[model samples]
Target: MTSADVTRPSPGRETPATAAWRPSRVVTVPPAVPPVTTGTLADLVLDWEREDPGAVCFSRRDATGAWRTAGVAEFAARAREVAAGLVAAGVRPGDRVGLVSRTRYEWTVVDAACWFAGAVSVPVYDTSSPEQVAWVLSDSGAVVCVVETAAHAAVLEDVRAQVPALRHSWVIDDGGLDELVAAGRGVGEDALRAARAGSGPGTTATIVYTSGSTGRPKGCVLTHGNFVDLAANAHAVMPDMLDEPGASTLLFIPLAHVLARFVEVLCLSVRIPLAFAPDSRELVADLQSFRPSFVLAVPRVFQKVHAAAGHKAASGGRVRAALFARAEATAVAYSRALDAGGPGARLRAQHAVFDRLVYGKLRATLGGRLTRAVSGGASLGEHLGHFFRGVGLTVFEGWGLTETAAPACVTRPGDLRIGTVGLPLPGTEVGLAEDGEVLVRGIGVFREYLNRPEETAAAFRDGWFRTGDLGSLDEVGNLSITGRAKEIVVTAAGKNVAPAPLEDRLRTHPLISQAVVVGDERPYVACLLTLDEQALAAWGQLHGRPGLDLATAAGDAAVQAELQRAVDSANTSVSRAESIRRFRVLGQDLSLENGCLTPSLKVRRSEVLRVFAADLEALYR
Candidate 1:
């Protein structure tokens, strides 16, 4: 209910220009959310248990790859037992419980049980380093931590001595869940119910940490009402995609990310059967086996799918490669035509031909039942979005931040926009500050950054949360994100450039895995490019340069020429001032372990620059 003062500036302003950027006209979507009166996530789960006790609520792959399902009643029973266990273990109301695990059945059980026990759940990415784990556990003041494996537990153990608040660590692989349940066997059902009843809209449900691409991670305090409102609004907006009978999604993105977390909660609240894949490597197999109706993934997943299809087709020989190329062209053209209005007879006929030969095969890789997907965490390239839509799988791109508790704006199925992130979610207001920074005010927005009141105050201007993302709204309200406001580079010539569009386009090149455009105060725009190891090897083989590694390929004139073509194509979309004039191909790839990329896969520009300072300096020289 509190609003930050909009008329004044706050601390931690990244740039002086933040105060100088002109605010764009206010853009607000028509309110379409029905009144959300859901009390809490635990309340929703209990409601489903009573309403449809026999309906399937969750499914996970067994050791032999068979899906094991749990019904609403069964799920509720297990969660209550876990809640009782937490109570027996001395976890009290409002206590913080850390969940350090992959996306799996136990993670869900513990998450739901946390709510049932009136405790706050804080998730640490399964891939996080010990220092990150320690930071989150300590910062959130978590008393107990649940980890997926002994290795995960070890990471926490290494940091346990540093985190004074953490008192217990349980490893799921070592019969941790069973132990908790057994410990609670003596606790009464009334006590579990009392714990569940203690939670309400005002209580913090979770503190989701940001991916920390720019700095140390900050925990965003999202309340029960935040999740309730987000789920209700999202369901109301995309009922056909999310609320249909037997609707399910194969969740593979780390649940530590807010986007994935929102989808998990949304599926539960809407009574949609939820399936879990251990990781991205197993995702394709799981999708093929589960045949989910829709999927929600980061843009990288889609890019990989697209790249794999291209590689597979090209490897089939010249005749097949030519046919695949034609099909892809037809798909892109047909999709563009449809977005312009609707496909014409000729375009429709072309699409029909490809649907049988190329599109159908690609869909089968996703298990043949997928009709829609949601891409977020970063920009789903405009061309890729159209290509997928053309191939019978419509990807509705949405945009949000960890602070927004998931989606603030999403493209609706009916009003699909190829390049835009669609309209703001119903009940969410979207506006632009003078500097073109996106501003959002909605029920889904988080209350604060846990224990970082000054940072929290600085994040909000008036009642709207400063998204710090530069974007625009179309005439009908479709939102197109341009770039990160803080990431804009001003060259020595005083020309401003947004790196995301260029970087996104560069990554579309099969040979390039990651691209970071630099030249903030330099003479011209340049980039540091990292090769995709698989793509590099494949390209090398195709070009009769077999056995060439990434390091060798980076210096190969032929490979450089091929990459230059991609850079040229990307440059065509922008003015000369913003064009990438030169680039350095780095032999090594940016990764989370190296601290060059965030857990969500965003490049850490500063880290990348620091590590490759000499290589980057060589470019301008």
Candidate 2:
């Protein structure tokens, strides 16, 4: 396709100008109920004693986390001991215990202890800012905190004295524990034991903080029933998800995310083993070494890895690139044909070519024995969405927030739908407010947002939590999220634009690694671009120019020409009004350290606009 022929959805497909918004058919939800009497995550943990008494339930990324021959029988002992310690240290049942740790063996231990003691485990994202972390501790009214590294411990030190409810902090010692121990007020081992030995089901399992990409974080108070219900429901929804008792996953995302916590509970519920990967360096290697059966990653990973492999293949002479390109095309065609559910001749012809070149490597990238790769946190671009499932890995797209106790909707194996975060999981009732806000309720609904009772009352009305997402559910009950209620931009011409779709399209260009559309009140739409480092370097080399530093490269006339071409290509499929008339290529990556992004990598819109005010003015100058 030429620069003017970028693949844009049809003109009338989803433009906000002509949107005929309809609420979700909330009544079309699937039916479900609790399977057993396991009142909570701890109750589920204890159940494993009857099933697999000697399987490894959890493992740290390091040698310390791996226990070759211990399962629930051992897990129960440790959790009970820890709960008893908490009690001995004065943590009462129902008190919130803040876990400011990375994904580790102790995370599960403390979480289970909270469940057993009828206390709440408040997970603090290891990457949260000091202010953010302090908010969680204060808001949740936590008494004890379980920290991971010294860095985390240090961040909490100054605030430790400020949070009146905080009495003690404990650190897991794989590497960064001393600082935590040093900062802690002090808790005896017997206290930990007493805390662990305390209660079950009907307890508040956790008060997980949501990733506050846009605003201040809210604490989602989930009960033991909320978690256990989801786990059992996940099993009922897809019984064969675990081939064996010890299925594994490499945990890289911050454990504070509902997705990560859900996977942890899955490990306890199904007797699967989860290996932690707290550091970025260990992520890929751990994936290969652990050979995990399942992988859950954001779209960023899928895009970057696929792009890198393509670059590598391109470097191997023209013949290799063309071969791989043709194979990909063939594979997509074959996959689509078969996906349409037919024994068609065209499908057979296409698959024959696809298998010889792409399937093997594709399978290897997914850890070889992969069953499915689950994606969430953001809406994945359409092309990448289809590309993953098209490559033979059963990619399941899901939708949820911390308030939902993990996921509310998921695309399971036999019920797969490529572009959408599929049907609502059993018991989640999805509805639409007058303003296109998606509201959800049911067993998965959180009890409340910590401390902010007024905010909590506003979010929940007549038993529904306004999701703040703008989306519509289709005939089959699958949701298609267009944008956020707050995130949508309104042009001066009164055109409502969902920036995610346009941003997704623009970022697909290798040269433009990240972008944010800006037309909220402007006459025409525009965007700010963050250049891809590798792609910029490659472009420099290809054009016979010495690669400059990021700022110099972004300002380079030649580099600007390349990005302009990319912008032109990105605009081809959209309407003139929606097209970006101009843009400024950013010199530096948007990051949290510099106050451009949140800890979770979401752009701080006001901060970015503030920092780049001159450049933004230059767009129209």
Model 1 C-alpha RMSD vs. true structure (Å) is 4.2
Assess candidate 1 and give its lDDT: 0.85
- Candidate 2, residues 1-621, lDDT tens digits: the string is 011121222110111333454343452244455433444566577678777777677655446644343466887777766666666567787798888877666777777767666578888878778888898998888898888877888888978776889988776764323333332235555554354454434456788777776677778777776777776667666665665444677777777778888888866776677777777656666676677888777666666766665555554555766676676666556556556775378667666656656766766765777757788777766666666556666667888777888777877677677767877677556666777788776556777787778988898655567788888766666777777878888989999887877787777665677788888788888899987776566555556665555778766898788788878877876888888888888778777676786555556776788888887777766
> What's the residue-level lDDT of 392 in candidate 1?
89
Best by lDDT: 1
Candidate 2 Cα outliers beyond 4 Å, as residue runs = 1-24, 35-38, 63-70, 174-202, 243-246, 314-328, 341-355, 542-549, 556-569
The Cα error of candidate 1 at residue 349, in Å, is 2.7
The 10-residue segment with the lowest total lDDT in model 1 = 1-10
Deviation in Å, model 1, residue 438 alpha carbon: 0.5
TM of each candidate vs. truth: 0.95, 0.87
User: Cα lDDT of model 2 overall?
Assistant: 0.70
How would you encode candidate 1's per-residue C-alpha lDDT over 1-621 as one tens digit per residue? Answer: 111223332211222334454246555544455435546888888899988899998999888879999998998889888878888999988899999998998999999999888899999999988888999999999999899999998888889887899877788999998889999999887887787676677678999999988889999999888888778778888888886766888888888889888988998878799898887787788999999999988898998898888777756655666787788888889888886778999888888988898999999999999999999989998888888988989999999999988898888877787789988787677778877889887678888999999999999876678988999877776889999988999999999999989988988777888899999899999999988877666666667787778868777999889889999999998999999999889979998878898878777888999999998899899
Instruction: Give model 1's TM-score versus the native structure.
Output: 0.95
